[model samples]
Target chain A: MAQSNFDRRRINGPEESFQPTFEDDDDRETRWKPGNPRIGRGARDIRPIFLTAGLINQANGSAYIETEKTKIACAVYGPRQSKSTTYNEKGRLNVEVKFSPFSCTRRRVPIRDAEDRSVAVQIQQALVPAVRLELLPKSTIDIFITIIENDGIEGCIAAGSVAASAALADAGIEMLGLVASCSAAVVGKEIWLDPTEEEGKASSGTLILAGMPALGTITSVWQSGSMTPADGIKCMEACQERYTDIHAVIAQSLLDNAQNNT
Target chain B: MAAVLLSKSERAYIQSSLKATPPLRADGRGLLDFRTVLLETGVAPLANGSARLNIGKMAREGGGGTEIVAAAKLEVEDVESGDGVDGGRVACSVTCSPAAYPHLSSNALDELQHDLSVILQQTIGHPSLHPRNLTIIPRKKSWLLNLDAVVLADAGNVVDALFMAARAALWDAKVPRTRAVQYRAPEALKSAKNDVPGAMDVDEGTSGFDTRDMARTAADFELPDYWDEGETLDGREKWPVCVTLNLLTPRHFLDATPAEEASVPQRLHLMFSFVPSAPPTLQAMRLLGPEELDLKDLKESIAFGEQYAKELFTALETKLREEDNRRNIKARDRFALMR
Candidate 1:
C-alpha cells in the first residue's frame, strides 16, 4: 500500500549502525613489550614529517604540515586593529582551531564541538607565551588551524602548534623563539613516540609538550589518561628530545622558503 | 558602516574627495575599480568545496585586506512534499571573528549575519538555478546544501569577500549520486489505501504524496556502492555572485575598505547571475544604510555594477580553470610516481 510521506525518519536505519572493533586483537598482556622488536621500535620512531610555509597566499603568513597520518594547515592574518576597546598595551593573539566534518575516522558534525573549542583554548594558551605581543599595541593577530585529518589528538595539537608558530613567523610577527611540539603515547611500560590512531586508541595515556627549544622554555604541556610521576617525567623528556628534531625541521623549512622567495 | 571610529579631519578629507568631479578615493583607485582580489579554491581538503579569498592584500603599513574562507557541504535527506521541494535547500551562515572588528556590538554582528544570510539565499537559491533532477527523488529524498563562511580578517568590504569565496566554494562543490526505489501496492489494494477515510484526511491537501515511501522501500532501495560516481550540481553558472557598492550621496565606490565604508553614509549590495544566452541579470539588490539615492544615481550604480560583475565573472572563470589544471597535473604526477 502507498504510505503517506508525512513525518518520516529521514533514513531508515539504526541510530548506531556499525560497532567499533579493534583490528589488533592480540592478547592484552602481549600487546606492548619492552624488548619486542616491533613494540620497541614503534615506541621510539616517528613518522616522516613534511612542513611548508607561505602556502596560503591570502593569509599574511601560512604554513602546512603533515605526517604520514596527520595533516594540518594554519593561516595567520593580522597585527591589524583589534575589535575590542580595552586599552591593552600588548598585542592580542587570537587562536581558533577546527576539525573538518570529514577529518576524523567517523564523520563529525560541522559545528565546533566542546572538544574542538577546548583544544582551541589550549592552543591559544600554548602559543601566547612564544609570541612577542608587546611589539604591536592595539592590534590582534588571528591564527586559524584546520585539522584536515587527525591520526591522534595529541599529534594533531603538536603539529598545529608548530604550524601556527611557522605561520606567525611567516607573517613577520615578532616572537621570542619558534615553538615546537611532540607527543608520546604511554602503554604499560612502553612510551610510543608520535602515536598513530591505532596506537593512540590502544594506549593508556598520552603526553604532549610544546616548547621553544632555543629559549629552553616549555610553553604548554597536556596530558590525558593516568601515569606514575616517574613515567610522566620520562615521557616529557622524550617529548623534549623530539621537539629538537621538529625545531630543526621547521628551521630548515623556513630557510628554504626564504631562499626560494629571494 | 565605519568599522572604526573616524576623526573629523579624516572624514572631511574623504568628503571633499568624493565631492570632486570624479571621486578620488583615499587609496587613489578609480571609483569603479575594485580592490585587488586574490582567491584560491580547494584550500580546505576535508570539505566538499572550499575557497579562501582576500579582497585586498595585507597592507605593509596601514590597515587593509579583508580575508574570508567559505566551505560547502551537501547531504542527502528526506524533504517534505511540495512544489519546489525537489530543487533542494541551501542554508548559508556567516560568522565574524571577534578580531574582525574589535568593538563590534553583538547587535551589529547579529544584524550583519541576518543580512548576509538573506542576501545569499536570495542570490543562490533560485528554483531554476538548482533543478529538481540534480538532487531530488520526488517525496523520498533530496539534498540539503550547507554553506558556511568564516571571516578570517575584516579590513573592510567583508560582503564582497564573503560572496566571492562562497561562489567559488559552490562552484567547487559536488553532490553524491543516489538511487531511489518506489513501492507500488497491488491495483485493488492501492485504491483502498488511497481512498481510506482517514488517509485522505492528512494535513493540508497533499494526500497523494507518500512520505513513507523511503521508509517502506528502505530494504529494497539499492544504495550506491563505494565505487559509484558522484554528481556536480546542474545549472551552476546560474548561481549569482554579489557586488556591493558604497554610495555616499553623490559619490559611489566599489569595494570600500572599512575606513572608506565608515566615511560613506549609504551602501548598496547588488547580486548578478548570468543567463545562458543572455546578459547577466540582477538577481537581488539591497540598500544597507538608511540614506537612499535618487533614481538617476541608482540607475548609474546598477550599470556600473553590471559591467564590473562581468569582469569579475571572467576573472573567476579563468582562475577556476587554472586551479583545475594545476590539480589535474598534481594528480597525474602522483599517479605516474606510484606506477
Candidate 2:
C-alpha cells in the first residue's frame, strides 16, 4: 500500500493546467513600463513595515510580517531531538518555504515547486551563520515559512527572512545576532526598493541581501536577472540601508512583545 | 565535497597559505587559476546537441577529476494561438549519478540534485535567446528544447563543471531547419478520407502553393534531414557562463578542487553573459555555505567573473570551431568513398 504514489488525504488538483491566453488581451494598465520612475516612492525608498511577533501559541516561536502587498508568516520549532540518531557534532537546521494556494495572482497547488526550494535554500544560508548550532549538538531546529499573500518573489523572500529571524529570537534561541533582509529591483536607470510583482517583471535585475546589522556582516546575497556591475553595487548598497530599518522594526516589535509578556 | 577529508592542521595550512600575498594553491597554481579542463562535444548522437567535460583531469592520470555530460533534445509540438510558446520553451533537469557517491545515502543525493536543478533552471532555462528562432509558425508550432545534465564524476565544484558542460552542449547544438506548411482539405474531404500527417515536405520548397493563404489552425512544421540543411542557435555567444568564487578569508579562487573546497567556508556563484566590445552583464548570483559575505572586495570579485567568462567563452568557441572543421573533413572523406 505504501508503494501507491501520492497522498490519499489531500485532494489533488488536475495533473497539469495551462494559463489561458487571448489575443489583444495585454493588461497594459497594470503592467509597469520600463524606464519609468517609481510610481509612488523615490528610487531608494522602501515600503513601511508592519511586523508582529508571538502570533501563534502552538508554535515554539512565530511572527508575521507585511510590507505593502506582500505578507509572510514564519514559525520556528525545536533544537529538539533529530530524526537521525547518529552522533553529530553540530545541530541541523531545516528550513521549508511554502506558498498558499491563493497566495499569488495564479493558483498554487500543494506541490512544492523550484521557487519554493530556492527560497528555502537562500533562507537557510542567511540564518545558519547567526544560529549557535554547535551549542545544541545532536538536535534539529525547524523553520517553516508560509507566504499568505505575495507580490514579487524576491520581496516575499526578503520579508520572510526577517520574519524567520524574529520567530527564532521569539523562541528564545541563542544566536550571535538577528539576521535582517531587504530586496530591490533596477528598473531602467532607477532602483525601486521593495518592488511589486509588476515592477520586478519589467526590471533589469533583482537583488536580495540579508545580513546581521549588529555584527555588520552579510550572511547571504542572491541576485538574478541581468545588470552591470555598477548597478549591482549600487543596488546592494541601497538594500543594506533598508536592512537596518527593517531590523529596527523587528527590534521594536520584540520589545513590545517582551513588555506585554510580563 | 565532504568525500575528501583532511586533518585540522592541513585545513589550516591550506587556508593560511591561500591568504598569503600572491596566494598559492596546493596544486601549484595561482589563486584565481582553474584546473585544466578537457572538453569534448557531440557525445550523444540521438540528441540534437550534447557535450562531455572533464575538469582537473591531468595527463597520465587515472580518473582524477570531475566529469559531466549534458544533452539537449528537441521536439516540435503544436501551440495555442498567442500561447506560451511565443518565445519557445527550454526545460532543464540535473541529476547526480549514484556511482559518484557510493558512500552517501539516496536522500542526500536527491537534495543535491534538486539544488543544482533549481539553480540551472533559473539561469539557463530562462529566456536569454530570442524565441522566434525556434518558432516555425507564429502562435502555432514551436520547438521545445529539453536540456538534461548528469554528473558522471564528482571531484569538486560540480556546479561550475555542470554549467560549463551545459553551455558547451548548447554551443554544439544544431536545430534542424524547418519549414511550415498548411494543409487545405480537398472539397470532398467531409468524408474524412485523407489524414496524411503535416500534409507536405520541405523538399517541395514552397514552389507552387501559397502557404500564406492557409489558416493558422491547419499549419504544421516539416523537419529538415540531417544530410546537409541545419542551423545553429543564433547569438549563442551572448549565452551566460557560470563562474564560482571560493572564499578563503581574504582570498578567493575559481574552480576549486576537493581539497581546496573542504577548507573554504563560503563561495559566490556568479552567472555572466558578455558580448564583444561591451561591458559584461550579470545574470544571477548566490552565496553558498555558512559564513559572512565579504563586502569589501565585492566589486573586485565580480570583475574576476567578467574576465574569467570572456576567457572561457573564447576557449569554448575555439574548441567548437575545431569540432566543426573535423566533422566537415570527415564528411568530405565519406563522400569521396562514394565513388
Candidate 3:
C-alpha cells in the first residue's frame, strides 16, 4: 500500500481500467441479449442469496450475506453513547462501509476510497428511516460493513444493505420491517437484473432501490447514467418483486441460527 | 476536531460576557490578543523550503496545541510565446488529518480544502511577487512553486496557522536562475506573413504597446536558459499574511480556536502585506461561514483589521528576520564541517 509522507494512512492513486483476457470473449459480444442476455443464467433471474446472523460474537448483532460473487459482513455495535452528543430527541445512525484490499479483481488500497464513502452514504440514507431510532433516544447506533468479495458495484451494495438489515434484527433493535435492495443495469433497451461485474461495466445506466416490503415504502432510490422514467419504474417494480424471496432467505437464516444456538 | 459542546448556561455566559463593557472572553484574553504560536523553519529535508507551526492555548485554557506543517517545492515548465506574464506561479493545497478533526465529515473537508486553496492562490498570485522580467525566457521556461500545507491538528483558527506556516515557507523558497535570449523575426519573414493566412500583417510590433501584448511577450515570446545559482523571490517585504476575525454578533475575536470558531456564525479573513518604506496595505478580505453581514459592519471590521494588521506585520517581520539569521548560522556551520 502507498502511504503519504506526512501521514501513515494509505492513499489510493487513480484507478486502472479493468481489462482481462477471457476465453469466451467472442461469445457475449454485446451487453443486450436477443433471447437470454445473462451469462449462462435467466435474464430476469438473480444469483443465489445466502444470509446468516450472529456470526460475530463481539458485536451486539452481526450478519453475513453472499449474493453469488458479492459477499458482505456487517456488525452492529452500540446503541451506546454518541461520541459527540448534542440535544437530539432521536438516536443518531452512523454507517461506515469498507472494502477489503483483495475484494475485487484488482488489489484495492487499504483506505476508504471515494466509492466506499459514496456507498456508505447511500446505505445510511436507506437505513435511517427504516430503523426505529426514536426508541433509542439520545444514543447512537454504529453499523460497519465490510465487503469480502465484489462481483459488481450494485450487487455489492445490495448485499451490504441486506447484511445490515439482518444484523440490526439479530441485535434485537426495533424496526418497522426488513429492508432489502435490488439492482438492475440498463443495457440498450434491455434491463438486466443482478448484472455481473463485466455486464455492469457495459451498462449505459443503473438503478438501485431499497425498500421495506412490509410497509410497502421505499427508503432510498439511486439512479445514474441514462434511463427513461418508464424504465426506472419498471426497474423498481422488478426490485420490489424480489423482496419476498430475500425476506424468506433472511428469516430462514435467523431461524437456523436460533436452532443452532441450542 | 470535535467542537467543545457548551451547555445552554455556558453559551449564555459567553454571550453575555462578550456583551459586557470590559468584554472578557471565555479564555480571558482581550479581543485582539492572538494565541501563542511556535514556528520553526527547514523541518522538512526534501522540500526546497518548509515550516512547522503550532498555536498553543494559554495555560489557563488547558488543551493541546494545534499543529500545521507546510512545504514549498519549486519546479520548472515551458510555456509558449503569446501566453502571458513569465512570472513564477504559486499553487497551494491544504489537507486535514481525519484523526485530528474527527467531527469534520468528508464533505466538510473537501469544502475547507477548496476555500483555503482559493484564498492562497488569490493572496499569493499578485504580479508584484513575480515581476514581469523574472523569468529567464518569455514563454520558454518559468518557475512553478507548489506550496502544500497539512493541518495535523485542529484546535481552533486552522486557517490562520496554515497561512502563517505558508508565509514562512514562501520566504524560505529559492527558485533557480535562468538566462534569456532575444530573437527578432527576419524582415523577409515579416513580409512573408501576407502569404500565411493567419499571420499578423501590422509591422509595428513596437507600436500601440498594448500592455497585454507585452505581458504575452514576456510569458510566451522570449525564452530563458537556466545555468546559474537560484535566486530568492524579490519584494519580500510586500508579501502578505492573512488574519482571520471571528464575528459573534456584537463582538469580534481574533485567532479563534476550533471551539471558538464553532461558537461564531461569521468570520472575516484579511490579507495584509507590508512594504517597509510605506504603510501596510490591505490586499484582500473575504467573509466566510453562513451568515449575512450589514455593509456598514463589514466596512467597520475591515477598518479595525487595518489597524491590527499593521501591528501583526511588524511582529512577523521581526520573527522572519530572526529565523533567517538562525538558518544562515546553521548553513555556515555545515560549510565549515565540509572544510
Candidate 4:
C-alpha cells in the first residue's frame, strides 16, 4: 500500500519528522485523536494526575500538566497594563501558542509567520469569554501555552484552556470562578471523550467548550465538521461532564500550589 | 512595555561593582567564575531532542528562572549547489525568543540571532566534509540540519546560556542517511583505452570494464573496501564551542550577564573548534565596542577564550560519548526483538 501522507511525513528521517505538518487528513485526525491503542494505556492508574504547581518561576503562578499522551506547560505572566488603549474597558487577556521547532512530526520552521497569529486568535477567542476581564480594567494577563506534546485535539484545547486558567489563578488573577474546558467528538455514532488526533479527524463532528461548571455558564463554544442538533447537544453534555472532572483537578492544583508556596 | 533607560549613576555603579573586588565579586565567585554549569538533554517531548542549560546566577535559581532551551530539527532536501561543493551538508540556525523579556526589541533579537547563527556555522560547518563532501551525491538531493535555540527566561548571561544550549543541541542532533553511486565519465573511459595500446588485443580475454567496474575500482581505491551497512553515520560532525569574553575595566570575564554586558565598554566573542588530539582552530572571532581594545587586554581575552574552549570541548565530548553508548544499547534491544 502506498504510504499515507501522515506515515510518509512521520518516517521522513528524525529531523523532518519533528515538524510533521497537520495539513494532511491523516495527520490532522491522528494527531487530534486520543491515546494510541498500541501504547496500551501504560499503567494509567499508577500515573500522577499529570498536574504540578508553580512550574514557571518567572510568572506569578504556573503549572505543568501531562496527560497520558498530551503534554502542556502553561505560564501566566501578569495582571499588568494592557499594551493597547482600545481594550481599556476591561482587563485584556493575550494568549500565545508556540510549538517548538521539534514539536510535531516534521521540522517546524520557527518564524513569526501567519500560523502563530491564527492560533493565537483561536486561543484568545476561546479564553476571553471565560476570563472576568471587567474585573481588572486596563490590565492584561498573558497566557503562554507551549504544547510540548499533543496527542489529539479533542481534549487538548479544553485541557490547554484549563491549564491556562490554573496558571492564571496561580498568578493570583482574580476571576468569577475557575473555567475548565474539554472536548468531545462524534465518531461513527460513538461519542468519544478526548478523542485522539486520528479519531478526531475521522469523527463526524467535534465540540470544544470552556466554562465555569459551578456557575453553569458556557464561556466558549466551538464546533466543527457536521453534526445533528441532537449530536451537538450530546457532545455538549459530554464536554460538561468532562469539564466537571477537569475543574476539580484545576481547583486541587491551585490549592496544592498555594500550600506549597506557603 | 516602554524601555527603561539606564541612568549614568546606574551604569557607573555597575562599573564600580566590577572593580571593587579586583576580579572577585560579592558572590564569592572570581571575576571569571562561570558559576556551576549544568546541562540536561532530551527533555522536551515535542522536540526531536532538546536541552536545557543553567549557568551563573541562573544555575543558582535551581532550574527555575533564567534557563535556556535549545532544540535541533533535521531536514532533508535536494542539495542545492550554492550549499557548497560538499556532498552532504549540515547547517544550523539559532533563534532566541525572549518572550519572557518583552522589553527586548525585535532589532536586538535579530542581531543576537545573526550572531548565534554565525557562531554555529563557524564551529560546526566543515568546508571539506559537510556540504562539500555531500556534493558528490549531486546538489539535486541532500539533507540539511537546523538547530533552534529558545530562551525561556532571561535572568542574565545570555552568551553562556546560548553556548551551553547549542552544545547540548549539537550533541543531540541525528543526521539521516545518504547513499551515493560513483561512475567514471565516458571520456575518462575512452582516455583509459587510448592510454593502453594493447587494450583492444586483450579485450576478448579480459573482462570488459563498464561504469560499474570504474565505480568499484574507485570505491576499492579508497581506504575501506567493504561498506558497513547498518552502521550509523550520526555524530560525525566536529564539535566547536563559542566563548564570549566581556572586557570590564583592566580585567576580563569569561561570561557576562545582561546587566554586566550593558555596563561593559567592549565585548569580544571568540568561536573556536577543538578536535581531539589536534591543535584547536580559531573558527571566527569578533571584537565589539565603541572603542578599540588595547593590545594587552586583547591578548588576555584571547588566552582566556582559548583555555575555556579546550575545557568545554573535552567536557562536551565525554558527555556525547556516554549518550551515544546509551542510544546504541537501546537500538540493539529493539533489533533483538525484531528477530
Q: How many residue pairs clash in each candidate?
A: 9, 0, 13, 43
State the lDDT of candidate 1 residue by residue for A15-117, as single tens digits.
3433355576767765744455445356677888899999899999999999977899999999999999977677888888889867986655555454565
What is the C-alpha lDDT profile of model 3 across B140-221, one tens digit per residue?
6766778898888888877778778888887776655544443454568656766888765566556685343444343333
Give the whole-model CA lDDT for all candidates, comma-separated. 0.73, 0.82, 0.72, 0.61
Record all residue pairs in model 2 with backbone atoms less than 3 Å apart, i.e. clashing.
Answer: none
On a 0 to 100 scale, what is the lDDT of residue A111 in model 3? 60
Docking class of 2: medium
- Which predicted model would earn the best DockQ? 2
- The better-scoring model by DockQ among 1 and 2 is 2
TM agreement with the true structure for every prediction: 0.49, 0.89, 0.48, 0.44
Output the number of the TM-score-best candidate: 2
Better of 3 and 4 by lDDT: 3
True A-B contacts kept by model 2:
0.76
For candidate 4, the per-residue lDDT at B271 reads 57
Candidate 2 wrong stretches, greater than 4 Å: A1-5, A14-31, B1-10, B20-24, B81-84, B129-131, B185-218, B329-339
Candidate closer to the true structure by TM-score (higher is better), 1 or 2 = 2
lDDT, candidate 1, B109-172, per-residue tens: 7555655555565456543355344455655566788888988788778777777898888887
Candidate 1: segments with Cα more than 4 A from true spot: A1-262, B21-23, B59-64, B80-84, B133-136, B181-229
Candidate 3 lDDT for residue B22: 87
Q: By descending TM-score, how would the candidates be arranged?
A: 2, 1, 3, 4
